[model samples]
Target: MAPACEPLPVQLGAPSTADPHARYARLREAGPVHPARLPDGTVCWLVTRYEEARKALAHPCLSTDPAHASPKYEHPPWEHGPPQALLAEAAGRHVLHSDPPAHDRLRNLVNRAFGTPRSAFWRRDVERIVDGALARLAGRDEPELLSGFALPVALAVISEVLGVPHALRARLEESAEALVTVGGRPATPNAARAAAGEVIRLMTGLFREKRAAPADDLLSDLASAADEEGGPLDEGDLIATACLLLFTGYETVAYALCNSVINLLVRPDQLAAARASPALLASAIDELLRFEGPGDSAALRYTTASVRLGDVDIPRGECVLVSIQSANRDRCRFAEPERLDISREPGDHLAFGHGIHHCVGAPLARLEIEVALHRLLTRFPALRLAVDATELEWHHLMPLRSARSLPVRL
Candidate 1:
C-alpha cells in the first residue's frame, strides 16, 4: 500500500520515444497509481497497473469532462475560450470529452455512421484507397513510410469515407497534426486554440456542405440525420463529431501501421508468419495493437467523486490518466508480456480502451490495418528497413506513440 501522505509528485513528461514500455514497467512496479504532474504542468493521478487501470477507466465517478478538474488545474484554451470560440469548444467537447446522458446522446448519434454494417461497407473502399496509395509508393528510393505510405493511406480513407473535399484535405491534414501536438506536445495554449479552432472551422463548413448537398458518406448521413434516428446534430455537435472522427481515424491508423511495420521488420520470423497465414496475420495485428497501440493513455479523466484505486484514494475534482500503454503490457494480466508472440491467443487490451468509452472506430481501424499490411507485404516482399532499427526515432507524444519516419528499401 502506498503511504497515505503522498510523496512529491512524479513529473510526467513524454517517455523516451525509443522504448517507453521499459519506463511504464518501472512505474507499474512502483505503485498502482502515482500523484504526478504533466509536462504541461497539470497535476493528476497516473494509474499504471492492469486491474487498477481497467477499473479506473470504467469507473462512472471518473469523468471525461473538463468541468470536474480541480481548481489548481489550468484549463486548456479549447475548454474556456470566447463565445465566438464555439468551434474550439466543440472540438474539446466531442464524444471523448462528455459523460453520462450527454456521452450516451453523442455516442448514439455518432454510432449511426460507424455501425457494423457501415464498417463492412468500408472494406472495399479501404482496399481501393490502399491500392491507390501503393501505386504512388512505387519507383521511390528509400521512401519514408510514414509520409509516403501510411499517413496518406489513413488520410485518404477518412477523407473518402467522410466525403471531405479534395481542396480541404491538405488543410485537414495540417490541422490534425496540430491537434496531435496539442494532445502530447508542450504546445502553447493559444497555439492549441488556433489549431483546434481551425479544425472546427473546417469541419463546420463541411457539415453545412453535407447538409446542403448530401452524399453517400458518413458526413452526409450525420449532416442529414433526422430526429427519428436521433435529433439532428446542432452546429456544435456536427462539427465536434466530424473533427473527432477525422482526427482519431487519421492519427491512430497511421501510427499503428508504422508501428506494426517496424515491429515485424525487426523480427523476420514474425513477419514471415504474418505474411504466410491470414489467420496468423489477424492474430498478429491484435497482438501488435496490444504490444504497441497508438494510445499511451486514454483522454484525461476527471474524478467526479472520491474513488479508491489500489490503496490510494483519488479525491473529487482530481484528474486521472489510466495508462493504456502500461496496462496492456502488465505481467499480471499477460503471460510473458514482454515477448511478442503472434501465435498467442488475443487478450482483451485497453488499446482502444474499455467500458462505455471504448473507441467506436475499432472495426474500421482493424480493417484498414489488415488491408494495408496485406497489400504492402505482398507487393513488396523484398522490402527491408533502410536504416538500422536502433537509429529510428519515435514520436514521444502522450496518448499516442509512432515512429517519426520509417525509411524502407523496396
Candidate 2:
C-alpha cells in the first residue's frame, strides 16, 4: 500500500444521502485502493478508479461470501435476514453470495427460468405493463411516481416472470416492502426478519401449489431446481432461492428507474437530447447506469490474500468495497466523466458488475429501464419535475442511491 492518505469512510452517510462525486474524483486522482474502515470499525480497503476496480471485481483473491469477510466487523453475517444475505452472505448458498462452481451451479439453475425477455411474448408483456403505467400517469395532476409507477412496474414484470399468484401479490408487496425497500435499505432487523419470514411462508406455499398444479413459469422451475440426486431442492433451499430471484429484482430495478428518470428530469438539455432521438434511449440508459447506478460498491468482497492494486496492497480477509459509482465515472475511462451525455456509450460500466458475479438479471433490468423510460418520455413529451430539483429527497442508502419519490406534472 502507498499508505499516505486520510482513511475514506464509506458507511457514514445517511441511507438517504447522495454521493459526493467529488470525493471519488479525489480518490481516483490519488490512487486506487486505500486503507479504509467500515462503520463497524473493521479495517478494510476501498477500491476506486476504473482499471484497478475491474481487476478487483474479477480478481480471484476477492471472496464474496461473508464467512470470508473480515471477522472484526460487528453483527452476524445474516443479521438483517435472508434478503440482506442475498446481498452479503452466500447464505442459503445463492449466487450473489457465491463463488465459482457453486456460483455456476446456482446461477444455471435459476437461468433455466429467467429466459430471454426480448422474445415477442415477454416484450409485449413489458410494453403492456409500461404503457399501462404511463397511461394512468397521463390523466393525473402532478403524479407521484415512486410507488405509483416505478415500483409497480418493476414488481409486476418480476411477478409475471416469477409466476407469483395475484392473490398473494398484495401480501407480497407488503411483505416485500418489509423485507426490502426501494431508494433505501431493508427495514430494521426484527422487522425485516418478520417480513422475510412472511415472504418465505407465502412463497413456500406458492411453490407447493405449483408442485400439485405445475405451471410453466420460473418459480415452478426454481421450486424444482434439483439436487445432485435429482430430487427437488429442500423447502429451505427452495424458499431461499425463490426469494433470491424476486428480492434481487424487486427494489434495485425500481430504484434504478427512479435514478435514471430523475437524472433526465433535472437536466433538461440531456432530457431534450434523449427525447429528440428515440434511438439514443438505450445508450442513455447505459449512461444513466454509469452515472447514478443502483449501487455505490459491489457487495463486500473479502480479500483471500494480500493483493496489490496499483500501489496499495489489500491485506488478507479485509473486506474490499469496490466503488462502482466511482469507477463508472472515472475520467480515465469515461470522457467528461461528470457530464451526463445521453449519447455517450459508457462501455461496460460495472452497473451490473463483472465476470462470475455479473448480475443474472441484467437483460431484464435493461428491458425494464428501456421500456419504462422510452414509454414515459414518449407518452409525456412535456413531462418535467413538479418540484424543484433541490427539494428531491434522496434515499439514505450507503452504496445504493435512489430518489424517495419523483413528482412530475405533465
Candidate 3:
C-alpha cells in the first residue's frame, strides 16, 4: 500500500507543493471523490481512486461540456485581451469539450488521421527526426537532452504530421511550446494565457490559408472536412481542433520521453536490463508511461445529475476532475502499484484516458516513446546525468508534467 499523508487544508484553488502522485495517493486514501475548486472559484470534485475514476470517466451522467454541465463555472483565463469569440470558441467547441453524438461527430472526423496505417507513416518520420537529432549530439560534451534531443524530435514529427510549412514551422512551434509548456519556464495565469493567445492567432491564420487553398496537410484535411450534410465541425471547431492537435499533441510525448530517459539513467538495474535485452524496451516504455504518465486530471467532467461515486453523492452540475495519475497508482488496481516493474504485463491503465474519450493518438505516442528510449539508450550507452539527479529542476506545479529539463552528458 502507498504511504499515508493528508494534504493540509487550504483555499480551494491554491496549488500544492508536494509531488503530484504523492498528493493523488493521499487523496485516494481519503476517498474517491473530494471537493476542490478551480482557480476561478468554481467548485469541483476530484475523483481519486481507481475503480471510481474508471466508472466516473465513462459515466453518462458525467459531462465534458462545462457550458451545459456547469454554466456558471469560470476558469482562469489562458490569455488576456483576446476577443471573446476566440475565447469562447476555445472554451466550448473542441472534441474534448463535447459529449455523446457531438463528441462522436467531432472525433470521427479527426480519428482517421491517427489510424494505424497512418501512424506507421508517421513513425518513419519520427525515427528520422530522432536519428538526426541524436547525430547532432554525437560529439557534444554535454547536451541538455530534453531541449536538444527530445523536444526537437516531438516537434518535428508533429509538425510534419500536421503539414506545417518548413518556413513557418519554427515560429509555430515556438508559440505552440509557449502555449503548451507555458513559456517552457515557470507558469502563471497571465503568462499561460498570453502563450495560448499567441498560438491561437498563428493557428487561426493557418486555418484561413488552408481553407482557401487546400494543401496535403493535416490543416488542409481539417480545413475541408465536411459530411454529405453540412460540415460536422464549424470554423471555430476547426481552429480549436487544430490548436488542440498542435498544442497538446507534442507535450505529453516529450515529457514521457524525458521522464523515461531520466528513469533509466537513475535506475541502473532497470537500465542494464533494458540494454541487455532489446525485447525489454517495449515493456520498459509501457511501465514508464504508467509509473510516470505526463498528464494529470481529465480537463473537466461535471455531473449532470446527482451521482454516487464511491459512496459520495456529488450534487447535480458539480464539476469532477478524474485523476489519471491517481488511478494508475492505486494499490487495489495493481500489485505493488508504487514500484516500477517493466516485467509487468498489460492491464487497464488510464495514462491516456478511458471510455469514449480514450486518447486518439495512443498508438503514435507509444511508438514515439519506445523509439526514442531505444535509440537514445543504444546510441548513448554511456549517457549519464550531467548534474546530480537531485540538482535537476522539476516543474512540479504544472498539471501536464513535472520536469522542465533533463540535462545529460553524452
Ranking by lDDT: 1, 2, 3
Q: Write out the backbone clash pairs for model 3.
A: 78-193, 79-193
lDDT of each: 0.78, 0.75, 0.71
TM per candidate:
0.90, 0.90, 0.88
In model 1, the worst 10-residue window by lDDT is: 77-86
Between candidates 1 and 2, name the one with more favorable lDDT: 1
Tens digit of per-residue lDDT, candidate 1, span 1-410: 55422354766655465687887787778889988777677777889899999998899999877778778765641221122134436544666777878678778767877773666679898999899989888988779988788888898898888889889988987866655542234345576567777777787788888888888788887677633354554567556766777767886789899889999889999999988987778667789999888777777788889999998988998889888889999999999898888897888888988988898888889889988998999999998999999988776656667777789999
List model 2 lDDT by residue over 1-410, tens digit each: 44334554544334544456777787777778776655445555778889998998899988776767666644432322237563222226556667766666667777756764433466788999998888787779889888889888988888888899888899899988776655455578677767767777787788878776767777777666653344444455556767777876777788899889999988989888888887888767888999998776787787788878888777787777788888998988988989988888658789889877888878888889998998888888888899998888786455567777788888
Model 3: residue 255 alpha-carbon error in angstroms: 0.9
Pairs in steric clash, model 2 = 15-395, 15-396, 15-397, 16-395, 16-396, 17-396, 296-399
What tens digits encode model 3's per-residue C-alpha lDDT throughout 344-409? 876888888888888877877888888888888899989999988777666543256546677788
Could you give me the TM-score of model 1 versus the true structure? 0.90
The collision pairs in model 1 are none
Q: Model 1, which residues run further than 4 Å from truth?
A: 2-8, 74-92, 177-195, 226-233
